[model samples]
Target: MQIRKAFRYKLMPKGEHIRKMKQFCGYARFIFNRALAYQKAQYESDNTVKFSYTRLANLLPEWKHEFE
Candidate 1:
């Protein structure tokens, strides 16, 4: 007689919460960099890099409607 042990590994996030968290991160970065750009313009005098949604949408903007 022999006994076996099973092991499992997942390479990806699981469930809706994980998906939403990723999207929220995308959206949060969008909002942060956007706000940061304006702050930089007003304060930063160097050629430091900045970013925002002026490039692309990460999380869907429609999600905001959920809060409103």
Candidate 2:
């Protein structure tokens, strides 16, 4: 027999914390959308293209530089 346990906690962010949290969420959403769009474009351009995480990660620096 085995036993497993899980824990969950609720956040009660205030003022500045709330603002920072929202900012981080926005950045995460942006990165995800960009990655999805890249993958999609690659697929559309090349039917035999394979998904590569490394390729996406390698592009991050370029993206940051481009956007900044």
Candidate 3:
């Protein structure tokens, strides 16, 4: 038999950390929404379309250049 323990800690970020965290969160949301919209379009255009992680992974570099 084995025993396991889990812990959760609350975070209190400083000003600069808070700012960076917000920026990251915003960027993540933007990317997620963009990917979701694209998937939706593909589905609307053709019901047989498959969802792909590689497809979105390929878009990351282009998105970075555009957003940055």
lDDT of each: 0.66, 0.97, 0.94
lDDT for 4 (candidate 3): 100
For model 2, the stretches where C-alpha displacement exceeds 4 angstroms are 1-8
Q: Candidate 2's residue-wise lDDT over 4-45, tens digit each?
A: 999999999999999999999999999999999999999999
- For each candidate in turn, the TM-score is 0.40, 0.84, 0.81
lDDT, candidate 1, 1-68, per-residue tens: 99999999976767987999899998889677765665577456656655556533543455356444
| Candidate 1 deviant stretches above 4 angstroms | 1-13, 44-68
Candidate 3 residue pairs in backbone clash: none
Ranked by TM-score from best down, the candidates are 2, 3, 1
Query: Which candidate gets the maximum lDDT versus the true structure?
Result: 2
lDDT of 3 by residue, 1-66 (tens): 999999999999999999999999998899999999989999999999989999989989998898
lDDT of the structure predicted as candidate 1: 0.66
Report the candidate with higher TM-score, 1 versus 3. 3
